[model samples]
Target: MPKGGKHVGKIASKGTSSLSIPGPPSSKPPDVTPSVASVLDELKSVIKQTQEEKEVGEQTLTGINKTHEKVKNEPRVSLYFKQKLQNQYVNALQAAKRELVLLEQCLKKVDEVKVEIGEVQARAAPPSTRNIDDYRSKMHSGLGTMRRGMLMTVLQQYAVEQQVWKGKPGESPPPLCGCVPADEKYRCKPADQVAARVRTEDGEEQWILAEVFSYNSHNHRYCVDDIDEEGHNEQRRYHVSKRRIVPLPRFKADPLTNPEALFRHRQLVLALYPQTTCFYRAIIDSPPKEVAGEYSVLFEDTSYPEGYSPALDVPQRYVLPMRETKKK
Candidate 1:
């Protein structure tokens, strides 16, 4: 082997880093391998299917056994008839047994794959939060490349806006062109632009407007931007699941356009229930219905004076749909 090849092997065996030495200056980029996330996803899908098959096999066996038991208990049944029935049941039971064995093998294979993936993650993952930042950078680069023209225009405008806003002497933004890196799989999806309820650290709950942004396919989480009544707030971009947010009441009303007005309305609702955040349990109450484009919900705000009941009669535009949470 060449001298460089020997060094490469030594470093690789030591597992010092995931990076490999590149070829001389003219060499192409290294080939990418399948990500652990994709492999694990496939394995999980197969395991779920295998479990379903196992359940079916067990059910089949149970039904066959029940039929066989009933036939055996019939005192007037003929010997040949009973023998035929037993033979059929036996054949079915054997088939079910074979299926069960196959499913068990599939489960074993799934376990092995999971262990292998865990090992790969341990070996390849970085020690700090840098990996997440890198992932986000890649996603943005990919999007920029795919949307070169539009993204470039936006970038230019953003630069001019920054320069004008900063008013720094001789500190113009860098010039950009329409050559965004291509990101084939990562597509920007429209955010869920609706008002919802969220709790603050102090346990005080209030209604906030929010929009869905990009999604992280690897982590399977939503990049949500919580738009306060003042509009899009950069500080509120968080990775949140659907369960943490509750839909707002949509009494007979139009969507509020002004941020200040929206904020004030939100405050009014909070004032009605100052003691606690909004709560909608799955078992407590049925979902509100839209009647003539309006929704009627009972506000169980404890902040109200004793024996004071507040009901929400509003338009459907005020209520946001439930966000779907994926099974991890």
Candidate 2:
């Protein structure tokens, strides 16, 4: 299942009206005196531990408390699993989610063209026969096409997101709230639907899922990364468990699986999850040559303009800008 699959930070629960068996209370005077400094020190440590254990669930928090039991004498501060750097992280998560699916499909499935090489022989041939030109030609063949789809998908997805965020044509965010049923939503994907993985001849890359999160000005960005503000601590432990109803990519059985399902699943999860939304920047590159090795998408941020659908042919009478400038 997607790591950190549970909502990181959710609304705190109100107490249930359950009887405590009406046990007799102790007559001893309550020792109200507490070591504020010591408790505060321990609280810091607990917070530190809490921050380290994100993208995790209640069980992990339980274990963390156990490890820090030595310092329990100190006053305890509640730990919550709140979202952090929400806008950038959530957008990054979605972008990562989309490209991940595309990359998996490109790596696992073969192109319909169906060309094969038992092993490429490093054969020396005449320059005219095979050289840089031939190498470029091979890129257009069978497997190349499959890889190209994924690369293009990543690039296009990035372009669309960039445009939306950068105020370019396609850079629009998904709807603000649940205006429509998640299943019926046009661009918004449901959470259980988003899961993606990439596999090469050797093995698969780590499985990942993306969900939305929100941010407020009160939280510290650096500290948020170290904590889940919804409080995954002993005092506020969440009992959320993994549900198998919707199979994420990691949990899927082999054989029936395909690249399409993973992509579809991951996309749905991101859209459906009701988390806060924010914005961030990212860079995406065209996919690498599959023949070289099944490298995953290489994304990084840059100031360059988002890509355009390259014109297939040069426009007639198009002149160089440099030439035009010089003539002027």
Candidate 3:
């Protein structure tokens, strides 16, 4: 079983409830409270003691074997005497085995306790500074005319980034672009999705999930959040041309186990002129032919463009529902 297997399972079974997008995973290091530290220290000591006990048990078994060998090899030993000696050796060996088994069980329990303590620490640590402020603003902003779906989706992505579900913050906010207010470029418009070029082990580059931190409005250069395919957050930023960054599809945050699941089939609006009111009517069954990981979707529109087909290739973050962007 996984460390958080039960928790993940519960989230999966509950359907999409508040628990699904609860607080994002914390990017800040876990706080080691004094009590937790003390508990860890105690566990370490217990492990040491159990190890010692196991060694002693092994020694006892060795001694029993030697004694039994000597008694069995003795010259002219009577059958009754040999039988009695063998019984004594068997009893000693069994006792030693029982002692070793008990010590092993204790060691296993100690590991379990350690993992539980770490989990508690992770759960207790607060979200990063940005998430706290963002969440606070959302709360205080009058609940009047709330776009519950949009708000939820925004929060989920915020949590994922802050908690670092798929990527980590760049080191020092990528050198600020003097031409464009670094702050302005960092802002991801509701219609835009952040993307970056990632170089793989075989010298191949792929565009993957990214968070834009800085952009040079003057030179068309951008500093984007760089991540590896395995989802481990990288500290370096990818500097690239403006054209390299692709927009993300619009999506609602679903309580899914991993980043991939969260990005899978979702309700999205076609990036067509927002005026036409184009939306993906159903979750796509699969991606377009020969294009892995890209969603192939059909749009529902009251009014259609002259050259438009019912199908298009859209990534999860790129799809925006018409309703969310109407007032923008």
- CA error at residue 198 for candidate 2, angstroms: 27
| TM-score for each candidate, following the candidate numbering | 0.26, 0.14, 0.27
**Candidate 2 global TM-score:** 0.14
Worst 10 residues of 2 by lDDT: 315-324
TM-score of model 1 (CA atoms)? 0.26
Better of 1 and 3 by TM-score: 3
lDDT of prediction 3 = 0.40
Question: In model 3, which range of ten residues has the least summed lDDT?
Answer: 1-10
Give a tens-digit lDDT track for model 3, residues 99-190: 44544444344433444454454444444322323433444455443323333334333322322122232322121110011233444442
> Best-fitting candidate, measured by lDDT?
3
Predicted model with the maximum TM-score: 3
| lDDT string, candidate 1, 1-328, tens digits | 0111100100121113321211112332343235534444554554455455546555656666676677777778778667766776776566556545544444434433444444444445443212223323333454543332332232222222211111133432221101111133433355444334454444544444455676666765556655321111233665654454433321221111111112222222221121111223111121222112223344443455632244444323333333333433
Flag the better candidate by lDDT, 1 or 3.
Answer: 3
Q: What lDDT would candidate 2 get against the real structure?
A: 0.23
Ordered list by TM-score, greatest first:
3, 1, 2
lDDT against the true structure, each candidate: 0.36, 0.23, 0.40
